[model samples]
Target chain A: MSRKPIHRLPAWALRTNGAVVLLFLYAPIILLVIFSFSASRIPGQWGGFTAEWYATLFDDSRLQRTIAVSVRVALVSTLLATVLGTMSALALERFKFRGRRVFDALLYLPIIIPDVTMAVMMLMFFSQSFSLLESLFGIGLSKGFATIVVSHVAFNIAFVSVVVRARIAGMDATLEQAASDLYASRWQAFRFVTLPLIAPGVLGGALLAVTLSLDDVVVTQFVAGPGSTTLPVYVFSLIRKGVTPTINAVSVIMLVASLILVAGSVGLQRANASRGRQQLRTSGGNS
Target chain B: MAEAKRERTERRRGFLLALPSFAYMVLFFAIPLIIVLVYSFATRTSTGSTSLSDWNFDAYRKLGEPIVRNVVVRSVILALVTTVICLVVAYPFAWFCAHQRQTVRNVLLVAVMIPFWTNFLVRNYAWRILLSEGGPISSFTEAIGLGETDILFTKLAVVIGLVYAYLPFMILPLYASIDRLDRRLVEAGRDLYGSGPQTFRRVVLPLTMPGIIAGSILVFVPSMGAYVTPELLGGGKETLLGSYIVTQFLTARNWPVGASLSFVLMAVMLVSTVVYFRSGGKNL
Candidate 1:
């Protein structure tokens, strides 16, 4: 393969630039991990290495509880977002509609809107409508588990829809038509053909939803009640008191979890893409 | 008759499948925004209950106040700075990824995205430590014969933080566009006696304009409204539209003013995005 003349630039220049960018990105993260193990009470000054921070993290019941709450919110929100987002993607992609473009733009509005604005608006609406909500549905809407889940699902749906819609657009519609022509009912056609075809997109969207919900602070901060604090909120409040190694320990754990989930998602996408290619080849051969 | 019934059933199934998303948007997205719009016009009582009153443009008028105007101007400027920095830094990185082999590209892309998965607040706080007086960054600077003054709270730190946080947003779209670029075009330009800069200006630049616009919108909009980074790194000296709105409601307890400010912020962002997209010749 022919290379561009830019490749003729001194090798050290390219290597040095790339290294600087990478270091700029990853150095703080590395420092965070290292400080988490430092015995020093201050953040910048590193003493000897110790596991005291991890032990301290375990000892903090409030942090533990907040983690549990965040997990619950992330799990439920991811599930809700995946289901709604997949259906929306299918509809937007497969159906011809008058307002399809409008719908698409509107769906993405939440994602583009600033989180602070969305959070405050959500707070105002829920608080103002609490009585109405209770009278109508026998449920009170306030800053709590229910509210957090709703907020997360609302925001995550946009991301989920975008990812799934792209995948749906890339898929061939003829397979579903062929399945239906074989005397399969609509449900069977969807199950046997469309669902599997879009499963990778769904998984990718769900993984994103989970990561976003878990990492959220602003929206969660606005909607969480006094009794319901997620990990990020707890950490934010903790920082006001001053930095601690325990916070770093928590960050490292989150970092590891996110890395695993992202790796899994990429692997799944590759598998799906290869499968799609094979299916295309076989269909072409038969035709 | 059976087939007709089956078709009807299929239509119903599609409607049912689409219902959840429709309801989700209507309830959370549409209604809350409607509430904000109404609150922008309504009067906020001493007790904080918003009520319909003689409709007034007082909130809109408040948008012109010096404090509000300053915050708005500052936010826009900061966002523009962040966007430009992200583009400058991300362009080379995206180009690098695009030229790499498939495996390498995937690895690099994953690396770019991994930091995004971590809590943004956590990452911002990491920068706090990095820029503090005794932090690695300061130490490195001092070691290189630069002064060891604290950089944590300055506007410089804020820009660095914003750029680092949003660089991925700029990189991803550029990578997608550049990855799809036809290499032959560049070769053809070179054969026509075009220099490196000329080929980049005429061919690669115009081709990636759409990606640049998309990435700018993604970075600039959020950077303007970003509270966590500025608040953490700005050491309470720098205030953006976001922190201002939050302070109005939470600290100041002026719900009407907060509601009004939030609406103004939204309006500014919407107008900017529309203008940006329109100027880029893309359909919103």
Candidate 2:
């Protein structure tokens, strides 16, 4: 933090620039929250403060259904992604194998590719597979909840694996080795020693996966079939039809919920980090 | 013999553990990419359906037509501008964030992410309201004697949308690199009689090069594929690559052409990613 002063750029100028950027990011958000409570039917202009928009939102069954669908997809996909990703992370981190680089690249591919491309590709693949199945056995897979979940899990796994892998790599391996030395089996070594150490990473990764699945729009739009619209996609449709204050209410609620989650996730990580440091200090005290 | 057998068992177990993820990727990621490649070379039937039977270079050849070319060029130019603007705006802010006290730094980082945590579509919708005619911004401009001009349905509005959406992507990465800056190097460069600017140019800039490239790539790639911002802010009047590609599938029903354009976009992304990594992108 003690870098030499950047004399060419004065401190006041730098501070102002930072302030503007922060304002640029937050002003619209605050405005949206304010207008969400407005009694006006117009989108942005404030007429009178009221909670009528929130009341209207409760009566909108379509929005409610979409929200339910989104929550279900988020939770299920996160759970699946967490389990699969944690396994992959442990395998990659704990054991060296041939084709490790190729495997790593394949996993990272989902992250780097743009969502539009992935969306199109997944759509094509799914439709083609459906065609093949129907041709052979006259069975069809409707692209609804399953399609959304599958597409989400495909990317979420990669994301969760990356987070969990970082956690696993940073963990002390000697604890597990010492467990084995104490006559514990390999499974017991993993369960008792490694699992507790990596729980924070797992939880963090799950939080990320759930939020990402909830926030996704582009990929879900392509994969979602009849009656499969998620909340964000539904919001996009509302925007298309000229946004109202009710939609603003929706956005405000969504934003507030995620802010809470964000706060919780960051707090959890900070707590875990301090605990991990303390554990290291105590465990290494003898040495 | 026992040790060898144990090693074999461990390897077997490890592979078993990784099987689910590997299988999922093979089914979803790898196969879909292959499908895009195959469809890109397939034929577009007269009814606008992609026929798998006939294979030709028609789609690739069609990519150079004036309309598609215009959209492609426009997208590239807009993405480049957005990247540059993000870099200029984010660098000073990131530098400032890095220099702040630890608690303040964390608070600033959290604030940046708070907007990001909100739904992207909702946030972009906010920009639409902000930049619309007779909105606060328009009223402010009029009060300041700049005149009330329509800005929402124009390229400038689209640029505003792109920058707002991707600015955080740029800031977070840049802050990470700047915060981890090695002070000893700056002091060393100064001790060697390098002036402040020289030391900054030589030491600080090079140290944060990774962040610059990463932030640039993060902002640039997504902005290149931008769909919603332009559609919402630009009023869908102008065709960028994103809307153009979506149009092929939805409105035009030309799957082969859409698939081909997708491949080209994917190729550009892959090449740039590899170039970035090859050029010493370690933190990635």
Candidate 3:
């Protein structure tokens, strides 16, 4: 009996379509990198090659300041979001309680809602109720780094919780059980067993949170004050003025930095997954 | 005795762990949203402070104006177009990835994710260069004897940019669903005298519909409010709801109108999301 080769058709079609899709996804990025070093003042003009744009970026104090601010915000927000996110993940995944679905949905609301909406809402809240916050907390909650951090954390919580929850759900309960049976305290069991198991997920979430905090423009624009300009916002202002090679240089640098972070995180996650699998295999063999 | 103490301590620790996130969300997320709801009714004072004395549907009523209506309709259409394009492109690619070897799948997934790591503003700007009159695309076209023309500021460019930016969102969920599918189902369909297309339509499509719905929501909702892509690519000649609201708050200084526009956009998104999840709840 001869079978008609239907599978071959799908395989061929997938390959052809996949290549076209990849091209569409990457062409803009490739063009950006190419134009960065084109040495021409005009975007499409090829006037030989030059390193002038990179040099100009280095000398631009304003851009540097904006980069610094963006880094600071991303750092602080990542730290705060990671800690709170991990805790929230633990609570939601480990415990069952009333209104759990509502809480879960509430946690995810920020991720689904457009950033601009969140930004405007935060602006309305801070600007309109300055006096109320001042009276309650002795500090005005207007635009600034503080506001950006709060907004970043608010959005990041959902991501972090989801990632950590997945890790928790996939984790083996026997490890914790074994630790407890070995006379370890509850805190000790968590610290040694559960924490280590969930650390990769938390780290992955933190990396994502950091990337988002750094690249965010909409929410940052609304909440950031006069002195709180970020790199993306600065780039936006620069583009409105005109397209300069200096902006391209900044883009290249951001691309390089983010690629490094993503590669590092993916590597770590892979290593953790392999190690977890290995541990499971060894345990299975021993049993 | 020890077990009882351990249980008590664990309970205390759980609450302690949860407190920080709860407090932060309450203060920032919950309160800001409430403020938006309140301001949707109250009047804006001459001094720029909002007064709550007059609670009416004035802002909601204003949404009936042609400009607001047009922006809302345009936003929905643009989002729908982007979602359809993303799904069409991403589905086949995701299916390819899912069928590939493990190493190949991992590499392709990373390739898809790497673009997202770049600055969104920078990526949009890059598109501007590529689509501008003197850009590579135009130059290539001219070299091939096609006349030079600017495509950068067109609505087509905006749609392209939106699709590019959100394609990853579409692909990832599709990959997840497709990868989870059982190959035996296809084989079983073939055994029952079903053709390949029939098997795919009857079996595979239904199984993967959840991923399609999730990916559509991920792409469409965000694209509806996309400001950066349209602003950069459309050259500000056109306005979507996001850009309109941004201008209102930042440039126009019309607090009531901006707040109202934002709420309306939110309402549209919420209703769509509710309808989508309700219909797609089983698969999701």
Candidate 4:
């Protein structure tokens, strides 16, 4: 709330710069939304507005299938990632064990590595594994839905663990200790005390995991086998072919879905923060 | 003895809790990287299938090739430009955001996040629409009597897309650092006869150096490894490191080359990441 003017730039210049940058960030998105409804087949040309693109999208079974695949992959991967990541976060935050630094670095690797490298690495991994299996046991496997889900979980775990670890780190450890001192079992301490405190973080991590899984393209593109294309990868393919009203509609849908997810995350965090403050105030009064 | 036993039990519990994640990373993440490393040294067959035997440094030697060098140089330049542009554009905006009232700051931060969290491919596709031959920018220029501009599929368009995509990465960290700035220090510097720019250079700049380094690494690493933006906006005429690496795998069918390129890119990213954390990049 403190408005201290530290920089000497003219107020008008600073305000104008802010406006221009916001416009730069948003103009394309606005244009994309408006033009998706345009009746013209050409992207820029605007005929009378129509909802034909949305109608066409409904009829595109290929798009529908890809969307379904994406959702399934995201849901399954997010579930696995939430459990694994939350456990890892608790371990990292609360425990002192051997090789902690190396484990920490390993956890961050998926997030810091470039998408292209991860993609190619996954490609090599799945292919080589398949050949090894085939040569050894005459059983073969290929990249598809399972590979996509596995890769999604691999990266999503890192993100989930980071978010959860931050929450766990900020939480007061004495609450659980107090529970135990009162003769509560460890499971009771965790379940009754720790779980509620970290629920927002868990939900936030799950939302992030779902969003990343849905939005992935580079990794999915490489690992996706026959009939395994997700929505974003499918959209990328459509763009490569040429821009169309269908692509616009699909893009808008994807954007809206993620917008809702992000909004939910922000809302949850804000609510938890206020509740935390209220709890602190009440606890202070008791003290 | 009882205390020691309890401590050992806690340690065992912690290890048990962490074991699943560690195992998953090893199997899915680390092993794949090791496979890439091994393949980087394997022999490429005439039919493009990799042979496990007859290892050589042929793939690593390909790094000195003229074509590969040109792509690497181009990618490095483009990434540097993107990083510099993002910094120049984001610094003042982050300062402005950080200086705002609480409500206003939250709104601005949310505005930044909306785009950041949106689908990456869709956002780039939006730019493709905006910069297409008959798109909005072209239409606006002609309407303003500047004549039509063919900006799509050019390196300039690619730069625009890169900056657009990664600008928020730069902004968020800068905002966090600037918000943490002690305004009293600035006032002190000014009272000591420091000019606005002088105070900024001597005090504010050093304080936010971590954010600057972190933001630059965040933008530069992805820009260097960018495949989608260049392929989408650059129209595939120019081959950057990302597209080049992909081409080696899919089109050229040279797995060794692709693996080696990937290994080098990951190494560069890993080093930058180490530098980023070492520089006290706490915001990210």
Candidate 5:
């Protein structure tokens, strides 16, 4: 609001530096998007534009199968994670117990620990557990689809709980109390009052879980069985085999999806913030 | 009697709500961590398979081997370089973002995150393509009279990929701390007639230390144990910790050594994290 201070000069430098960094962040993806349409087989050279790679993406049964597996894993794990995480958040946020702090830290362990450690441990445990099962019960659980889903849920639940718990911690307690005062039982209040109020948080948590599940690679790699490769894993294998324009096409699609999700999330947050402000304004006006 | 009944009900309700997640975490996360810890002590036979019998500190001892030692050193160095680069590049941007008006800040933050949420492999793969021969970066370098570069599979490529991949991790935390900074403290510092650099050194840096450490840990720990980036970019020519541990398990079939490496990596992360928390990075 005041005239630009002597300090404001470096602010321009800061903004320029920020812009450069952002451009660096985005330039590769933009190149990928542009090159996705190149008819050239090589990712480097640009031929005439074509949608050939997108067509290839649809026809590649291997890529399609991996996509299917990733979707299935993401869907199942997100669902399970949302339920489990919401429950944990509810218990942790809404109650007090002797070991509450300890339990809360334990719940966050998965989020703090690196992905590789978690993946390797899960891989070791599942392999041993499967071998033990094969010996004792004559049932074998392979390290592909089932393991990936379970492994995903194991970490996904923790992330979901963090998101949902933050939301719950900010929520007003008196609404549930009012519901109980209106002759609603505790279970009924939670089901009808608490659930609806926290639906946004639950949805946000589920969205986060979906992204985390899809973005996973290290854990999925260790536990993936034959024919159970997820998209990221498949992409890694593709990169190893040698990158092609097809990878560019895949990268373009993923970039678009991520951009959409980021936009949606930012929009949702703005909406939520505005609604909270309006509620505050109304309450203050009443007072 | 009524009060006792009410306490009992609340306790039961909390237990019922928490049961499924608690049990699942115990079965999958805690149990596997214990299994890995136990496996770390097991003996690796000449055949590369670990024998649970005759468990000792052999694997941990093997961590001193030149090969393992080199990988640990290399991974830590790479992680440190990556963390430093991320911090330097991210600090200005995070400050810029935090200083912007609310709407602009929101938009900028989302733009920064879009790259992160994009598939990690996809982003790294894009870099490989860009760094490969005739790629955009290569062409730019050539046109600038810097000459052609064959960096795709090299250690330099791995660092570039790492800095790009984890920059957001650094920026987000820094932004959180900067956004929470009280403008009056900054104003008071400026009123003391200290130069911008001096004020930042004396006031801002200390205030943002928590974010600095948190971001460094977030970037450093994962970069030390990185897989997708180095694997995609390093071309397996250099053995970083992530690939080395994977090799120990999947290829070399040496589970004990792999477990030891994993435990060591986690131990490093845990120590730094604890240090950060103790130093007032408590919002985690």
Candidate 6:
């Protein structure tokens, strides 16, 4: 462009600051990964690179069980959240209804609320609800896999809906109208036209839900009963008990898992954005 | 009459489509929050059970207790300091990113967010490792003849962890505002012979005020109610609001007091979030 403005920052200064901040962000994680392979049991001492910690993880049955629980919970919760969130997104995007504003605000609550507070709320709610059920119908329950799934869906629904709603907002409503005008039933219109258009968003939301459910610790800690500890919760306890070589391995595994998922998510959204741009370019002034 | 009937059916169908999610949120989220508020007034017995009968303001009054006040003040101060540091660091970085070409900006933004997507607990654990005795930083200091620095389990470590954790929150919003800024105004200010600082102060700062407010709230709200950072880094020697509230419920078994503190924290977050939304911070 024209000669750089007087107020523009020097390139070297910007690069240095960016490098420092990035290093601050990444060094700890990179170090943790490196130490995970250390032959020494002591965390700070890097004896030699070995795969013993990774081997140790496989031998630990406790870790295996927790991973199983986390997977089951994440799968079930992500499914439920995707369905509920998609339905809510469709309702908000396609309709003009009374109390819509209220519905919108309520949907955002679970997201904006803090994690610890949400954990406490769910704890209190389950306890009180279980007691009430016992007193009234002799049915008793406690926090476990079911409660964890429920808590996860509560938050995931908001996140999923936000993602799906973005997709729905970008869509051409007239396509659905066209389908209906062609004598397609409402269900048929949604199934054929709307669903295919928003599939990427639905999948993206599900990916996010599963990741969140898997990574959750604070909320799960409060709601999980004995025998129901998820992997992250178990890892959290291990860290609290003090660092060990095994925790390093576990942390590295977790880091890699999330890294892959995030890369997938970013890739999916990028592809979707480019496709939207292509559509716009092909159908100029359609909006 | 037919038109009216058709509109009515559409409304009914719309409500029906959303019914399951609406019911779930009300039952699990809204009602539970109401229950938390109710529990705040319930009586806590000496035996540590919360009784519904004979509700009182004892729990609310305990909010004024010296111990509670200290924890609240500490949480506020720590949160405030974290927000300020995050802003100071993130603003320049965000500016740098916004000034970059599109491909570079996108790459930089994604790099910033990679930590955010990774496990939260694990990130804090990474810090625990870094700041611990004989950790890499300490070893480096020792190598430089500065002696081993014992920074772990201290409040300073807690602050560092907090800033590290929430820096992305500040940067993203600031970048959004900066990228959306009209460059012509800056040029106009310069053409009027305004100094660089004056152009920034008069035009840039005011235009990006929304981002500042949004980023501050995003960072501050979570920092105030932080549980994991303090638990991992603060060494439990000093109780912050989040850990203190957990203690009342899990350890102390004083539900009323815990519920009250939770309610107050929720109220503060809700207010700040409302301000954030009003300032057009819907990008989240």
* Most lDDT-accurate candidate: 4
DockQ of 4: 0.76
Cα lDDT tens digits, model 5, B45-124, are: 88777789887999999989998899999999999999999998898889889888988998898888878778777788
What's model 4's overall lDDT?
0.91
Residue pairs in collision within model 6: none
Comparing 1 with 4 on lDDT, the higher-scoring candidate is: 4
TM-scores, in order shown?
Answer: 0.92, 0.96, 0.94, 0.97, 0.96, 0.97
Model 4, runs deviating above 4 Å? A1-6
- For model 5 the local lDDT of residue A18 reads 81
Residue-level lDDT of model 5, residues A111-215, one tens digit each, is 878888988899999989999999999997677788898999999999999989888988999999999899998889989989988887888888888888888
lDDT, candidate 1, B1-284, per-residue tens: 99988677656665666677877798888899888887778666677665677577676677799988888898889989999989987887788888788888878887887777666777888888788778777788888998686888888899999998988898888888888789888888888988778888898888888788878888888888888888888876789888888887777766767788788768767886787676563532
**TM-scores for chain B, listed for all candidates:** 0.90, 0.96, 0.92, 0.97, 0.97, 0.96
- In terms of lDDT, the poorest run of 10 residues in model 4 chain A is A1-10
Which is superior by TM-score, 3 or 4?
Answer: 4
- Put down candidate 3 lDDT per residue, B181-270, tens digits, no spaces: 898887788899988788888988888888888889888888888898888898887688899899978887767777887887787678
Candidate 4, residues A148-234, lDDT tens digits: the string is 999999999999999999899889999999999999998999999999999999999999999899888999999998898999998
Q: Candidate 1: fnat, from 0 to 1?
A: 0.47
Q: Which portions of model 6 show Cα errors greater than 4 Å?
A: A1-9, A284-287, B278-284
Please identify model 3 stretches exceeding 4 Å from their true place.
Answer: A1-11, A97-99, A133-142, B1-12, B44-49, B280-284
Error of 2 at B279 (Å): 1.6
Tens digit per residue, CA lDDT, model 3, A37-102: 888888755667887889888788888999999999999989988888888899888765444566
lDDT string, candidate 2, A49-96, tens digits: 899889998899999999999999999999999999999999899976
Give me the candidate number with maximum TM-score.
4
- For model 6, what is the C-alpha lDDT against the true structure? 0.90
Backbone clashes, candidate 1: 1
Q: For model 6, how does the per-residue alpha-carbon lDDT over A1-287 read when each residue is reduced to its tens digit?
A: 55455456777877888999999999999999988888987886689999888998999999999999998999999999999999999989888677788899899888778888898999999999999999999997877999999999999999999999999998888999999999999889999999999999999999889888887888898899898999999988888888998898989998998898899889997999799889888889675
Query: Model 3: clashing residue pairs?
Result: none
Of 1 and 4, the candidate ahead on DockQ is 4
Predicted complex 5: DockQ: 0.67
Estimate every model's Cα lDDT from 0 to 1: 0.82, 0.86, 0.83, 0.91, 0.87, 0.90
